[model samples]
Target: MLAGHAASGQAPGTGPGAAPPTTVAAIQQLDRVEVAGRHYDNAVGSTDAASQGTIRAELLKSRPALRPGEVLEFVPGVIVTQHSGDGKANQYFLRGFNLDHGTDFATFVNGLPVNLPTHGHGQGYSDLNFLIPELVDRIEYRKGPYFAQTGDFSAAGSADILYRTTLDEPLAALTLGQRKYQRLVGAGSSELGQGLKLLGAVELLHNDGPWTVPEQLRKANAVLTLSDGSRAEGWSTSLMAYDATWTSTDQIPQRAIEAGFDRFGSLDPTDGGNTRRSSLSGEWHRRTDTGATKVAAYAIDYRLRLFSNFTYALERPATGDQFSQQDERTVFGLGASHAVDHTLGGLPARSEVGLQLRHDRIRVGLFDTQARQTIGTTRDDKVRQTLLGVYGQTAVELAPWLRGIVGLRADQARFKVNSLADSANSGASSDHLLSPKLSLILGPWDKTEWFVNAGRGFHSNDARGTTATVDPKTGDPVDKVAGLVAARGMELGMRTEWFTGLQSSLALWKLDVDSELVYVGDAGATEANRPSTRRGVEWNNRYVPRPWLLVDADLAWTRARFADASPAGNRIPNAVDRVASVAVTARELGPWSACIQWRYLGSGALIEDNSVRSSSSLTTNLRLGRRLTPKAELTLDVFNLFDRRVNDIEYFYESQLPGEAAPVADKHVHPAEPRTIRLMLQLGF
Candidate 1:
């Protein structure tokens, strides 16, 4: 092509008429290179900031963790917690924040939001533990609100999980290794063909991992998928199942508390929980010259259980007694989404029209096991909300090298809270939101592509993690607490490929969110009407210099601050100041591969209050693998290789407190894991 380089720089694959390597001359003849992912096996190669894949021949050749969460590590603004590597309670953080551990990311499996309608405080109780490693053929992340039909994603983002179809022939694999630092998993798939597919995988993960806590993790996962031909056809149906059971432990250090990294130093590893999820969905579509018409329906169920004793007995200055106690929460949800749409993209213009409806309900209860009474006397509550929306988007090819996309949507929700024990406290309210988006991509150079995007999106009220307590007198909690309403954000980004197989993406974003609920420090609880701002940047890069080796890196930095005065005075907890990672992968021998990953994390804010925070930290992971065949592989991995001293509590002396702040600063940092390693072997037939 242009010179001595490959035309499109795409890795080798088995497909019809693939593009030449990514050199100037080759690209001129072949417009774009296709990569493997959920939507299309032959879509253009992505230099996008939040897009990546493991299905690429090169990436798949090396044996690695089979879960989508593990692969997403290469993306910016994303950090995953294996719950001590157990896999069942797997967790993640985005935009320097966690959505109540698993609740916020709004994970999806095949265009379906994995969140359950009944999850407590919107905490994620979806089915991340459902799929066996083999069931997920590939995974994808659609960051921000760039696409149509998808709006109301607060600060973090959304993820799309794609299941691998069963092949015509039978396949089998076994990944036997340590969980946490060492564990094992086995998987297989079969194709009945003629409009049928099946995939399945199961794993046993154990980790006596990298934290100071007496770490131990165990969980099992399985996923099954049955789908008709592509949606382009007339009709299709899909079935899915997800499940996982796990328990984890944490031990925080007392000194790290003084450093401002956490609220408490340690958590008894004996504290543990179990979780599960299941779902089903179907779609029907008809294609035409002008646009494609489609209708779809989906439903999901999820559950979670937690049992732990709060052991950090920090003496409250006024009470002289720590609020130490045993706690448990049981939550469930039911929901369905129905939408009809006209898709427009193949012509000189792009457009989509659709309407969506969703209903969600959550029930929550907590009891102080030690005291033999519910923590607040009236601990049971029920909240239900319904969302209806009409959305549309269009893209026009302005010129040869430029294109633009414009989109708009309107949404409304009505929420009602009911509790038999506190009927008088029940209340009902309605809210509406409008969203608009604009995006433009420019191609000045064949290999250099740039994009600028701006959008305004909002949503009605919802609470996360923190819930209201009883009034102590009427057995009723505050009704209008923190109504999540009308949040807005803007996203700007760019992506490009450079010399020597390097690809990079940069994004800058800002968010302003307002909630009707407010927090009160004096009462050690919250009420209603609060606002905050989330602003940050995400930087990511990938380098595949040779056919058998690659390197990936990502950095996420944010400054999420209170936009209005709160009982804590413009302060919020759990938002980290910074996070970064670097990973290197190697495949020098046929059937052999190795990898190493490094992480750097700045201090994190406190969990329920802003007075304390987590500490700065750094850790590393190393792995080795050998491929026995195309469908089989083996590997060994070590987590927290250094056994670096980790601290979960960060305390500030009254000396460091800003004027008029709490004098004794004590924050809790959750310990990660201790150094550990695992060996694994997997096979496919």
Candidate 2:
């Protein structure tokens, strides 16, 4: 499965430019490492209270990758699953919390939520497979909720991805690389005409044949943006379009091979799925005489078809039969924000408010025939979500060195699900949510800052529009769910750059989530649980010793607990117990620069019937590249320098009942190509 997720949130701190370190401790600390006002800076010390290092651009480029999974070794408290020739997919955990779908850590893009809001019957899905690494301009991560103004998931903090804007110098970049085990990658981007910018990339990647299994990857993407710097009297208007295709069919270990596991299987490279997504968005900003107001509207069309050919099953034989599944989704959304600068309580303050509306449609088709035949069991559903939100915040100096910001964001969102069958639609329900936030920045000395924040937030229950299965045999899928989920509490702290070039932050938090989402009992049964709590801590920091050389590190630890669940009770699942990374790079060696990166993940734990068990593991990857010319470049990449197996997946099979009956299987980590090297060159002029 090829998927991706975005890490984003509003960049921290109110300061927008370089200013002399004031007497404010918190403000100074935040400002030192956050010299980013361009793209999106996630490592802005203001967000992570527990951060021990920073992940700035120089630090990032030293071991740059186009997606979060590729940069796994750089961030602590996270684990990555890599196929010999496939893309990186992460299983997230911060502090000790368990992430959804193995990949925790919520994602965002330009402040736009990407976690698929699904039917209330199941947990929301995050599609992190579409993240294109080359398009990113900057990445900022905060370990704990130390200096953050706002964040999602009461426990785990947030990471922001800042894409390059349509700024000067007519941006352009192309990457061409090869893996000893994988095929190749050819990606490029350029500016089109005036008022418009364009970017496109494609990968035909593959892995080694002599290795245990054969893996391959193919994908393409395009993006176009037109900007009018006139936001209706000092505002800006932008018209944008995005399209992409992704498919991955790598090595599939056989059932017997996975048990204790026999290690015998020939490579079958053509298997995974094919996916396409298209979206168009319009954004307009008005800086009229009456403050500034911004509005955006968007429409998205997404479709995916997966040809899952069974190669491995617990007790089941490798079914020659394949399940060709297809999913279609359409969504529409609108958001508007208005900021006003004024004086209240004899202090200068700013207030901003916004709103969002989204309509989603989903269709899942299960085709039962082989020979590439199609017989659709259409199960279609639609959901309308309306979110109403308003916030009021003000920052004032209680003294020359102390500043505080308090704000309340009230949000009411309702989800109405309607099934294709009228009888099954009664399960449709609605949920509303409101959250409050507050924070403070204290600068007690020059070039440094200290911050603390607290807030209340919540995630609503999903209504998938299908009725519950009343009968075990003819299970019913039905009525929409109602009422919002339980509210959560959060806290944060941060300190950064009292001087220049170095910054850090640390945070600890806990979240009590109500109506947990999960899959229970049968093969296709999905349901929501009673209550659960997620708690963890994160640390991030950055250090720049020279203009061309940079170094950085990060760590996140999480603990997610399922609480009061009837079918299952008080359990903590295994996600990486701890994740950490270190990167070093210098790009000024006359077009020849070297970057080295190291990643470490402690162990994951199994939460069942109360007690916990751990799976200890670790892995690392490295790469070296040279810029051949202005438009062409070459890179030599190596994965698993020491060839360490770290992934473990335990499962029970029930179908292959025979004299050769083996009920369960353990999937060992089969990532990284053998010790191989390749060079790629790309050019576009």
**Highest-lDDT candidate:** 1
Q: What is the TM-score of each candidate against the true structure?
A: 0.76, 0.77
lDDT (tens digit, per residue) of candidate 2 on 333-426: 6666555555558754445555555666666434432423443333344555554545555545555455666666665666555555333443
- lDDT (tens digit, per residue) of candidate 1 on 1-685: 1112211111111111111221111132323322222112222233222332223324433434434455445445566654332433455666755544344455555545655432432333444555444444344454554444554443355554545544444544433434334435555555566866555555555444333453454555455555555534444345554444434443333444555634222243344555555556655554433344556566655555544433333322222211222112222222222222223354255455666666766564443332222334223457676767776666555555565667787777666766544555456766677778666656536556566666555433343212334552345555444333455666676655544466666778776766523222112234453677788888876666675666767887888777875565564566777888887888656877898888776777664355566667788888888777786666777767897766422433222122223334333235555565556665555
lDDT for model 2 comes to: 0.46
Error of 2 at 459 (Å): 3.4
Report the lDDT of model 2 for residue 479. Answer: 28
Question: lDDT of each prediction vs. the true structure?
Answer: 0.49, 0.46
Among these predictions, the greatest TM-score belongs to 2
Q: Among all windows of ten consecutive residues in candidate 2, which has the lowest summed lDDT?
A: 14-23
Question: Residue 352 in model 1: shift from native, Å?
Answer: 0.6
**Residue 683 in model 1: shift from native, Å?**
1.9
